[model samples]
Each structure stands twice: as C-alpha cells, then as structure tokens.
Target: MMDYQLNTPLNGNLAMTSCFHENKALQQDTTLYKFIWVRSGILTVEIDHIPMRLEQDEIACLTPLHHIEIKEVEGEYLTFLFNSNFYCIFGHDDEVSCNGFLFHGSSQVMRLKLSPEQSTNLNDIVRIFRQESTVRDNLQEEMLRIILKRFIITCTRIAREKCGVTPEQEKAFDIVRRFYILVDQNFREKKQVRDYADLLFRSPKTLSNLFFSCGVPSPLRIIHERVEAEAKRLLLYTPKSAKEISELLGFEDLSTFSRFFKKMTGESVSDFRKSNTTGSIAN
Candidate 1:
C-alpha cells in the first residue's frame, strides 16, 4: 500500500483553489473541484484510487473528489485547479476514459481538452492562466472560472484524441456518475448497498455487476469511499469527535468506525487530526 499521507483538505468551498506542489511519494491529496494540465513530462494520475498517465498537452478535469499524485513523473506542470461550482454554470456532457483513471465522468470534463486547431486554443488558454496567475487579479475567483472553462474545452478535445472511448466505457461512466451523486446525498443516512439500490431502483447485485464491469469497486466499497471522504472532511473542518463523526456518518459502533477509518486511510483518526494541529477526534 502506498503510504498516502494527506497534506490537508482544501476546504469544502468549491471556488477556493490553493496552489501547491506535491513531493514525490507523498500521495498528494486535496479535496477540490478543479483541472490539471500537463505542460511537460508524464504524470501517473489517479482518481478515486484508479491510476492513469497524463502526458504533455494532456488536460485533466471533472475530478469527483480527487486522490491524485505525480508518482515518479517529474518537471512542473501548469495545474489550474479551480472550483467552478461556486458560480453555478451549466455546460458539458457525461464522458469517461476508456483507458482507465476514472477521473472524470461529468459532461463539462468530457469536452474540456485541446481543440482541432492543434493546440492553438490550448496555447491561448495557457497564456491566460499564466497572465492571470502573475497579476493575481482581484476577481481571482471569476478569472479562474473563465480560464478553467477554456482549458476544459481544450482538455476535452485532447482526451478524445489520445483515448478514443468505447461504448462499454460510456456505460461504466454513467454508473459512476449516478453512483457518485447518490453516494454523496445518501452516505450519511444510508451506508448499505440495499439503500442505494432502493434509491436507484436497481438491485444490489445488478448495481454491483455494472460497477464491476466498469472497473469500479463494489457497492460496499463505494459506500466506504464516500464515508471516508466525509470523515476526512469533518476531521479537517468541523471540530467533531470521532464518536460524533462516526454516528453522524451512519456508523453503528465506535470501534467499527475506528477500524474502518484506519483501513481506508493508513492513520488513526486522532493522528490525522493532530497532524493538522487539531485536537484528538475523541471527545
């Protein structure tokens, strides 16, 4: 297992993007709605723990809560991590990579890569990111919004080129889309597989089959993913105790929660909190 130590949660807000770098083997972690564009070198990228590679001129977006890292890849890439949800905009189609990674399934991410002009549009967008980044505009939020939009468009095109997706990929992508959305909404009260099946109107076995075909983990594992993500969120922001958070997140027993949390994130709840200068998560 990779010794994935999280730097910190980048807050719950969707529009506040903090720029930073990840040391190799740190398993660079952050919670943000953003995109990454590789200026140079190959980056071993992962989302939801699925890994893929990002080469030069390749752009990555539509991250549904990313757990990415640079791996052994080196050289700085222009990463324009942004939070576009703060200003609710509507644009995009559902897309998924047939190759792997499972990093993006949202429509906007589907169409946000380089264009046919052969990187002409992307070059322009990169220039904009550089310019805005240098000036540090006061309307930083909105500036990032626009720049990211352009970068996304380019990324979509690039993705379509590098990896021609398959119909099976489309099916897997849809399942992931609905699965992620449902998990986010119901992870707190409904942690069981049957709970999600009831809401999606699909049988647990059927749903499990779909996810498996799409290379997604089992439904139960999906539940743990959401719960773990929320646990990290609470650990970072709210001053909640382990017992409180476990109960709030639908865990029935404190020891069960502790065991699972440690398994998902190779750290105790208290140690995680303490690393960030927070009090022990035990009340």
Candidate 2:
C-alpha cells in the first residue's frame, strides 16, 4: 500500500495534501472541486469512466459530481480540494469566469499540459498555499482566496489558449453561455427552448441562430442533454428511486422518465443504475 499524508483542513473550505505511491483508489466528493498537480509522476486516472494519463508538470481540474479513480501512480503528486463556496466568493461575476468553462463543464475533467514557465508559476503559487496553510492568522483565508483566484485565472488562460478562443469569438459565445446558464439553473422544471429564450429575452429563432453560429448543437438539444446529464448523475450517485428521480427532474410520472432515459441513453434507468453503481466509488 502507498503512504499518504492527510493535511489538516483549512477553515473547512480547503484541504491540501500530497501522495507518493500507488495507493488505493480514491473518489472525489460531490460537494467540492479538486485540482490534481503531478509534480513528477506518470499517473493514470479514470474520471467518470474515461481514462487519462498525466505526466510531470501536468494539471487536471475536476468539478463536483465527477467520479475519479487514481488507477496508478509513479512518483509524487499534490492535490487541492475546495468547495464552490470558496471558489465563487465574488458571486456570479463574469470577471472571474471559471464556473462553467472549467468546473461543471461538459467535459468531466480538464487537463492542461503546463509549459516550463507555466509549471514554475503554478509551483510558486502552490508553495505559497502550503506556507500559508501552516499558519492560521486572520489574513490566511483572504490570502488563500487570492492565491486560488490567481491559479484559476492562470488555468483559464491555458484553457483558452488550448481551445483557441479569441476575444471576438468569446463575444459571440455569450449567447450560448447565457443559454447554458439558464439551462443549468432551470433544467429541472424547464426543458423547452422557448422557455430559455424567454428567460434570455430572445426569440426561439434568435437562440437557435446563435447556437448554430457558435458551432454547437441547437438550443433544444442542449436542454435535453442537460436534463439527461442531471438525470444520470442522480441515478448513478443517489439512492433515489426511479419514480423519485423522475419527479425530482420535473417529470410527471415514472413512465415518462423511463421513456426519456431510454431515448437519451439507450437504456432503462434501472439498468443504468445497476451498471454504474458498483464501480462508481471505493470506500
């Protein structure tokens, strides 16, 4: 078995730790976000059934609700765990726009291969975090938040570069983003493109046009996907019954949810749960 260091939790909002072995499998908490930085290792990780390989100086961002397994590790790694409350201290401001693009994104994990300079920069930030974590002064929380903001912003820059996102393109993507925000906030009870359009003060046609221009699926498709995603999360992660999950997702009855799940995932809710439950986590 691999040895592990359980660092003390900082203010109940953040936990920092390091591991240096091929330890037992670990799963992430659904209520917190995680950043895994491989200082010097070749690690194979599985996130939500997708296998990923990380090397030295690489970083991976995982959001709440992702099922992660550290399949194998060779060398050392550092990880930071924090809740969304700590991340969104400025509320829903667009200035620090990482909530959607990094965490809670369609992709379960975002991996960034750090350049040498980038690696050095991130390492310095992590050093500060480690140094501050040892001291519990009044300014510790504020300083941690500031450092975290800097790290997230840096990661966002890398993500933007990897995706080739330009300012003009970002401007054009505003409509698509707003549509997703509305869907995320209201998909439980509202599943129609027209409803989202109304919320965004845009016509259905306009929304459809923007989605098309942005090279994404149509508004209605995105809404259905969001609903399906949440339904799957509930089915796999929670003990709620099919009927309860259906009602929680705003479906009128079990049959309706059954049909919807079958249509979207090509399987019944029961079968999906049975297949996903056992391998989801390790205690």
Candidate 3:
C-alpha cells in the first residue's frame, strides 16, 4: 500500500495510491476532491449514508462536501486526491469543463463505467502520473496539473457520452450544469427551483423542461434532495441539535425544518438520528 504524495506550501496537495484504505488522512480531509477508480473487483462506498457499489472499470468522482465512507474493497483500486490549490475546478472550468458535470452535478454520487478503450486510456494517463510523481523540478507542478487536466477531460467526455448529451443540446447542457452548481452553492438559503431559474435566466417551467429533456432529475426535486442530503449528513455525523442544524441550513424555525424533513424523508429528525446512530454503533 504505497502512497505517493506531492505537497506544496501554497496548499497544493495531491496523493495517489492503489489502496484506498491506506490514506486515512486524505480521506478525512474535507478540502480535497476524490477520484476512486476500481481497476478490478468490487468497491463499496457509502456517500451521505447511501451505499453504492462499483465494479471493475468504474470510477466515482466526489466533491469535498460529501461524507464518504469506504466500506469495502475486494480487489485493486486507484485513488487520486487533490485540493483546490493543486487545480481549482472552478478556476479552470473553461479548460476541462468538469466543474459541474463530474463533481457537483447531481445529488447522487457520479460513477462512470469505462469502456475497454477508455480504461486503456486512463491506465496510460495513470502511468504518466506515477512517473511524474518521481520527478522534481520547477515545472513539476505545472506538468502534474496538465496530466490532471487531461484525466479530467477524459472523464468529462465519458460523462457527456453516458448522459446521452448531443451536440445540439450542448447549450442546454451547460445551463443544466450551471443550475446544478448554483443549487449546490445556494441550496441552504435558496430552497426553490424558481430561485435557481431566476439566476440561470430561465423560467421554472423551462428549467423543468430542460431537465426532462436531459432525463435528469427535475429542478425542484434536485433542490429538495440536496437539502435532504445535507440534513441527513448533519444528523448522522454532527452533534448539533435539530434547532442548530435548522438554523445552519437557514430555516426560519425548527418546526418548518422538521416538517420539511418529514416530507422529504419519512421520519422525524430525532428518529432519523437515533436510527442511524444505533446503526453506526452496531456496525
């Protein structure tokens, strides 16, 4: 379980390893984005308490905000961890265009199954990544960034293809991507689809239509699911009371949040917390 890491004083951090469990420090770092590629066998992960399984030749792209628990790994895998300082997705969105589509585009974890050719391409890039990790020079950082950008571009292309996005829908796709980013950024304060629609300069109905055409979740459902996911994460991982979480999530009052939670999920806050806590303890 060898870990190869590159760290710079300017907060540039990147770590690569074949064993995902070996990097406890990186796993706990909230500021890092994670890419988990299952090269062989099965990998199980729980994101925001929802478990997912990845088979061979699959990869999951995750953002900093997600609560990720690597439950099991049955065979070989690769993990790439990097902070914003290494390469800010938002800062260089125009270059790779992965800011929204790969990381923050959906409430669910983004997993892509690689074709044989795609897997070969990724393996080639990873070889270069391993080789570059050993080199030290003034241009090492830039070189690594270039490789990372290439990796991101490859994943973005696969994602676009998997989403069935056509060239004709590229403009609409960008709008949907922007909507996802905006909802991720503002869901705590802005709970309505109309809010995001206004920010995207589209009407709520138009946003719904676009999402429908893309076969993605509806705009309102995306907002509700994002809020619900955060609520569940706080409940399962934090000691904050419901009132505190309600305030943190920008609810006017506890009752409103309580009702929203019950509507989104089928349980009250206390019950949800207790059930998950007991489950964790048992585990």
Candidate 4:
C-alpha cells in the first residue's frame, strides 16, 4: 500500500490528495463519497467488486455504499473526498441535483469520461479548490462550498447524459425524484411499490413506468436496496444484533430480515457482516 494521505482542510468535510502511481497499491473500503480525477496515466479501482480503469481526463464518483479497493494507479491523480452530508445540503434544491443523478445514482453508472473542453473546465474548478485551501479568511468555507457545488453540477450534467436521463420531462422526472426521496425517507416503513404508489397518488404500474422511463431501477429494488444499505451500515458500524437490526429496519422478525437480505445480496446477514469485517481487518 502507498503511504500517502491527504491533508484535511480546515473544513474537515473536504480533503485533497495528489499522487503518482508507480507500482503501488492503496486498498481500503470507504464510507465517504469520493471523486477521483485522473490527471494523467491509468488508475485502476475495484468498486463494489467491479474493476474499472480510468485514463487521463476521466473521473469516478463513488458513493458511500461502495466498497472500493485501489488496485493500481499509474501516473498522476487527484482525489477529493467528502461526506454525503456536505453534498446533500440545500435539500431538494435544483442547484445541486446530486441526490439521484450523482452520489445516490446507480453505482454501475458513476464514472464520467470527460471531453477535452469539459476536462479543462473542471480542472480550472479544481484549481479554485486548491487556491481556497491556502486562505484562512472568514469566507473560506463559503468559497469552498460554492466551488464544490460547481464541481457537483458539472459532474451531474455529465452523469445525467451518460445515464440517458431526460430531466426536461418534468412530470415524469418529478415523480421519480419524489419516489427516490420517499424511499430514502420511508424505506423502513414502506417496502412495497404499492405503498409508495399510494403516497405518490399514482398506481403501482404508473409509478414503476415513470421510474423505468427515467432510467431508474425497479421500485422494489430501490426500496430493498435502501433498506439493505442501512442494514449493512448498522451491521458494520453498530454493535447491534441481527434481531435488533431487523427491528430497526421495521422488519417483522429476524428470520424475515435474514431471508430478505440473503435474497437481495446473495449472502446471509452474518456472512455479510463477517465478510466486511474481515476485509476491514485485512486492510
């Protein structure tokens, strides 16, 4: 593993690292949202067990749910790591449409291969992050937030395009957007598509159609994934037992939760927890 770590800025929400890969391995699981910009060379990463090679001018946005191992990095690369709290501020604001299109979007479509002009634009924004870090002014955090918003907006645009998202279809987009928010907020209490459909004043079929049209996954998958994400987080970060976790996620019983988890992730709850903990130990 490479012995490199980024210095945390005064606003600890953000950190920057610059390094060149040469026969080095940096492997770990991360809970923060990570943006890695490949300035030059090839950077290889395994996110959620899928290996990706990002070349020059390409960037990867990894959500907190991913387990990433930096398999190999050759050449220069820059990384910006921040928590979802920072990214999700200004709730439901159009300025930072990051909740679905960027951070919380599908892990399969997270990377953005930048064009030359887009690369220059984003690189310039990155320079601003570097510049703002050197100052201790009262407005430093404010400046960093503005820069971060721009970075997110730029990435969101490219990500939407990559995912074939048509945000201009306001009615369909809003339905799906609301569905995402409702699932995030109520996945524990509402697991079925019919439940969400009732809340959205649309039939289950209509709701599912909207999600499919917007390139969103199936409603049941989204709801189950959200619940499973919380289950994994609690299992990894909390000292809660299976029964306790099941209760916290509003499951009727531990048996049902275990079966659901196994069905969704192809692993038993105890096995999944052990796997994650074992990886943490290995790291």
Number of the top TM-score candidate: 3
**What is candidate 2's CA lDDT for residue 144?**
80
Cα-based lDDT at residue 39, candidate 1: 58
Candidate 2 deviant stretches above 4 angstroms: 1-12, 20-29, 49-58, 89-92, 105-107, 134-136, 212-217, 279-283
lDDT for predicted candidate 2 compared with the true structure: 0.72
Query: Candidate 4: deviation at residue 179, Å?
Result: 2.1
RMSD of 1: 9.1
Which ten residues in a row are the worst by lDDT in model 1?
1-10
Runs with alpha carbons beyond 4 Å of true place in candidate 3: 105-107, 278-283
Best by lDDT: 3
Q: Rank the candidates by TM-score, best first.
A: 3, 2, 4, 1
Poorest lDDT segment (10 consecutive residues) of candidate 4: 20-29
Q: What are the root-mean-square deviations of the candidates from the true structure over C-alphas?
A: 9.1, 4.1, 2.1, 4.7
Estimate the TM-score of every prediction.
0.56, 0.79, 0.95, 0.76
Q: Which stretches of candidate 4 lie over 4 Å from their true place?
A: 1-12, 19-32, 46-55, 63-69, 83-92, 105-109, 235-239, 274-276, 279-283
lDDT of 1 by residue, 1-283 (tens): 1111112143313221212344321123343445565556666754433457777655666453444444545544555443324322222333222212323332212323444475677767666665665454457556655665555555544664445446557655555556766776678888789988888788999988877766557889877876886677577656888999989988888898999889988999999877754454321
Looking at model 3, residue 202 earns an lDDT score of: 87
Candidate 2 total steric clashes: 0
